[model samples]
Target: MKIAVIGTGGVGGYFGAKLAQAGNDVTFIARGQHLEAIRSNGLLVKSVNGDMHIPNAQVSDTITDITNADLVLTAVKAWQIKDIRNDIKQIIHEKSIVLPLQNGVMAADELAEVIPEKQVMGGLCRIFSLIEAPGVINHVGFKPEIVFGERNGVQTPEMEVLSQLFDNAGIACKASRDIEADVWKKFIFICTSALLAVTKTSYGELRELKETRQMMIALLNEIYAVSQKKGVKIKPDFIDKTIAVIDAVAYESTSSLTRDVWEGKPSEIDYQNGTVVKLAEKYGVDVPVNRFVYDCILPMELKARGKFNRQTS
Candidate 1:
């Protein structure tokens, strides 16, 4: 299969390397030292499942460099989707599929707004991985699976073929009959944990303290309310189920949003919590917990981008 991996970050680098290792034609779209390193050395993945190295990985900084992709896996940050829409559209043909492995629920919709709706698929990934350095990706936890399907729940031959391609690369994948539910299921966990992690810094700490645990539950409940209002079919008891999954993870586990904040980098705060808040307003639902978290992190996010204005009293 011909694949274009936009944003060679943790998710893209690891999956693209695995696909390339399986002898598929995979082009990694990246920039800066990362692209140079992949061009000179190789795309390296250090995984708990197993390490992989693609010595001759095809990589490029320009999106137009590869135009005949059968599938385009967009792994950029949630806030970056709109910015790269034009670039992505330039590479995909009419038959090409675009799967966004982002954390937010609106990623597929965001892509559909720019690209053809027929070409966009609802998708999400389960993996705890990150770019440890230029040309290097580290997969720390999770079995690393991808769940995706047609936006309208129709089963297409392309979905089956993509699943097979992932399977051939020894990657766990599922073609869901209801991809929206799958995306929301993942969103509950991410939004709750990510917001809590911003203040607590560790999953273990959030789960241990009674006050923090309650705060996490409150955040989850608020998000659940917003989802229900938006007509997403999430269960009422999803908070309990999501908390169980959070407890199962390592105590030290922290979300990418938390990591990005601590590392002083721009994050998807506006897209994740901010999106929830936006939807809450649209649905006339109160999401105080999500709003509070979003407000708390906004200053740091703005400062990271050199947009924050400090005032003197």
Candidate 2:
């Protein structure tokens, strides 16, 4: 199948390379030095599974260059939804399944508002990928999974065909029945993890520090409450289960926001804690914990605009 990977960052770069390596007609839409490097050489995925290089790829920064795609994977950040959304109609085919692998519940809704004709499939991607450099993507660990389904869980030909393509690429993928539940479950963990470790400290520090550990628990609980209010059927004893997952891992696993803040990049607080806050006001569900997180990270918005207070020792 002909595929177009929009926003060739960590998620797009790694997954698109896999599909392309599997002999699919994959065109990566990218820009800047990264696009130049991919054009000169190819996209490189440095993963625990081993390095993968796709030489001689069809790539262009413009949407019209890669028009008529069979499947278009929307991999851009949530903040860029409005920026690149109008291009969807320019490139996407009628039969294409626009999979938004963004980390939030509003992905389908947000994209549907723009391109409702393009079949918007909700994808709750489970991967720990990070862009090591402009042309290099460092996929940490090996367990990368992509679960997607239509807004309604019908056995569509497009969904089935996409599943087979992923299988051909040797990726563990599936067509989920309740993708919203999956997204909510993943979002619960992510919101807690990101908010708890945003203070330039690792999860180990927060878990070891009694005060911060309690705060982490509080944050997790608040997210859980919001999830319940939003009518997402999380697993029973979900908090305990998630905490066990957290405890089983290395103590020093920090959040992406912490790393982004440290490296002076924009964080996804508005989509995360801000999501909960908006829902809290919508449902009249008091989420003090989520509200507190909103307050804590609101100051970081200035960081994106070169206005954050820098601490010096």
Candidate 3:
């Protein structure tokens, strides 16, 4: 399959590299030092599963020279979507499937606002990865799945073909029955973990401490409640299922948001916490825990952005 990855970051690079490794036509759209590295030294993937460097996959700074992508993964950060929309539309053909493997619920809608609605696919990619260096992608943890589907829940030829593509790429991919529920399930856990992790010093400490778990549950309940109020149907035993996952995960593990909070890199608080609050207001529900979680992260926003060294007005 012909695939275009909009970002060469961990999620984009790792998945794209795997797809390319499987002998699929994959183009990586990237720029700056990372782009230069990929262009010169090739793209690298380092993970427990395995690692390899793809020297043949095409890399470009602009989409003007790109075309005919069967699937385009819009893996750019949430904030970059609006800015990159024009170029995104410029590259891939109209019938190409565009999947936004981003956090939160509105990513597909956000892309549709720019791209044609018929081609936008609802996507959820959960991978613990980061750009270890300019040209290198580090895939950590256990989850390496990519789930996506049609907006109307009907399995189209494109979706079936997509499932085949992902499987061939060696990703634990699935075309879900209820894609929204799957997205929300992960979102609930992620938002909760990120919010609670900011309160304490470290993920290990939080998981070991009683208070951290309490805060985690409270914040999770608030987000869960808000999800229900918005009429986004969740699994019948979602709460139990989520709680079970929380208990099963390694205590030392934390969300990338919390990692950004500590390292002082820009976090996805605006989309994660802010989105929950917006839904709360829409549903007229009191979301004090979520509100508090959002408020607590305000000061850390700049810190999460790596702006601690610089002064702010």
Top candidate, metric TM-score: 1
lDDT score for candidate 2 against the true structure: 0.79
> Which of candidates 1 and 3 reaches a greater TM-score?
1
Q: How much is the lDDT of residue 281 in candidate 3?
A: 95
Candidate 3, 1-313: lDDT as tens digits: 8888989887898889998999998899988999999888999999978888998669998876677777888888766778777777877776788888988888888888988988988888888788889899998766788999888787898888888888877889989877887788878877874655467544456556787767777777888888888777885577767777767766666776777766766778877887888888999878887888787786778565556576589
Query: What tens-digit string does per-residue lDDT give for candidate 2 at 1-313?
Result: 8898988887898899999999999999888998998899888899988889998877899877876888888888776776777887678766778888887688788888888644888886777787777678888753888998877666688788879999999888989888888887778777764555355566667677788778778877877887887788787698888777666555666656567656667777777888888987877777787788778777766777678788999
Badly placed stretches (over 4 Å) of model 2 are: 306-313
How well does candidate 1 score on lDDT at residue 180?
Answer: 90
**Which pairs clash (backbone N, Cα, C closer than 3 Å) in model 1?**
none
lDDT of 1 by residue, 63-98 (tens): 888978999999999988998888889888999999
Which portions of model 1 show Cα errors greater than 4 Å? 311-313
Taken over the whole model, the C-alpha lDDT of each candidate is 0.88, 0.79, 0.80
RMSD in angstroms, candidate 1? Answer: 1.4
Error of 3 at 237 (Å): 2.6
Give residue 197's lDDT in candidate 3 (0 to 100).
47
Reference-based TM-score of each model: 0.96, 0.92, 0.92
Residue 211 C-alpha lDDT in model 1: 84
